[model samples]
Target: MPDHDEAVAAALDSYQYRLLPDHIHSHRADPTLAERLIDSFLQQLARYADRRDLDIHDTLAELHQQRIDRGGPDHAPEYSFRLGAQVQPRQQPAGDKAGNPLWRGFITALAATPDGQAQCTVRIPGVNQALHLTTAELEPADSLLPLPTRTAGIVIHAQEAEQTIIDIAARLKRAAGNGLATNEHALADLAQLTMRLSAWSGGQPDAIMRHLYDRIINAAHPPPQD
Candidate 1:
């Protein structure tokens, strides 16, 4: 396998300039091993960019204009160089007292398979032990109950929604996995879950969890706005 750490670091460093081409260049040297690493790096970078509300086209244009204004580099660096910029990786939102989707809104999914199954793992800066949430299926029927239409007594259990969100979040993360080469499986899975979850949220009888579930699954909402 290719060096994922190196690829991700390179991708992040080149967020404004030559990510795509550098990614391509990396693979050109050895397509067999480097392709997947480059692909995954791009996916994560795009998601990171989106969360920062960074427009790749706009950012690139600005960088190009900067180069023109600066009359190109005084001298091209002998090695790969990174212009200083902050990289804000997505962070898990604060959890609810009950620990639900709204509370823990951020989740990351590590390598996903072509099948619906995904490995949802969370790693913290200081924590020695990592947390892993493995979701084998996409449907909420097994782990999460059907959302209800009303909030009369909607008891949102911390564990229930947390696990369900873990699964749903994994699918969402997978779905957003797109770059030079698309993760078609993740794309299809995300589309499938979005429609299914939207339908589930609309008709479910519980009002409380319905809204929470909707926010959890929908790509556009709870807005990734800064």
Candidate 2:
């Protein structure tokens, strides 16, 4: 196995021993032990990289790139890296050739409290937590839906024209996980969601979700601008 795969092998070996101590010994006499060991090593390496806060996806991408760089009839396939003699480089997947994946917008929602000092509450699907945000200076006085007293929202695919109906756990903090009181993207760029009133005034989760259905009618449909 390659030096780069040692960590993965170590991790897998540790797991294998825990599950079946005799398994390694049994494989010791098998002709395919070396290849299986290599596969185990790679998996272990990925896990270690994840624990160390390393970007394993990027690591894998780099590995694939390296294979491409060494692209001649001298390498093996990813699954069969050591199965046999050198082979031609693997071809890129069909998806890569297709235009960039049209990601259905990541679903999100916005809700407001009826209290006088209401806060804008945003709940994203799949995330266990509701991101509580503050919009003290962003809510405009003349906007149709006045930005609540001190609440905020992120505009993820706000223009996708699809409403994501999601049920959020109560503010009881039981069903909820963590809260993001501040905006993650506070700077306005071409593709970023910021907190500035002019930038994110229309980004309230509710408003964004409401617009999704219109996208089906016309993606070029425009929303009220700040």
Scored by lDDT, the top model is: 1
* Residue 178 accuracy (lDDT) in model 1: 40
RMSD of each: 20.7, 21.3
The C-alpha lDDT values of all candidates are 0.37, 0.34
Candidate 2 lDDT, 81-127, residue by residue in tens: 21111112123435334342211111133334565332334332112
Q: Which ten residues in a row have the lowest lDDT in candidate 1?
A: 79-88
| TM-scores for every predicted model | 0.17, 0.23
Whose TM-score is greatest here? 2
lDDT of 1: 0.37
Show model 1 residue runs off by greater than 4 Å.
Answer: 1-179, 203-226
**Candidate 2: where are CA atoms >4 Å away?**
1-19, 24-31, 73-226
Q: Tens digits of per-residue lDDT for model 1 on 134-185?
A: 3321111111223322211221322333334335454555455642444555
Q: Report residue 138 deviation for candidate 2 (angstroms).
A: 56
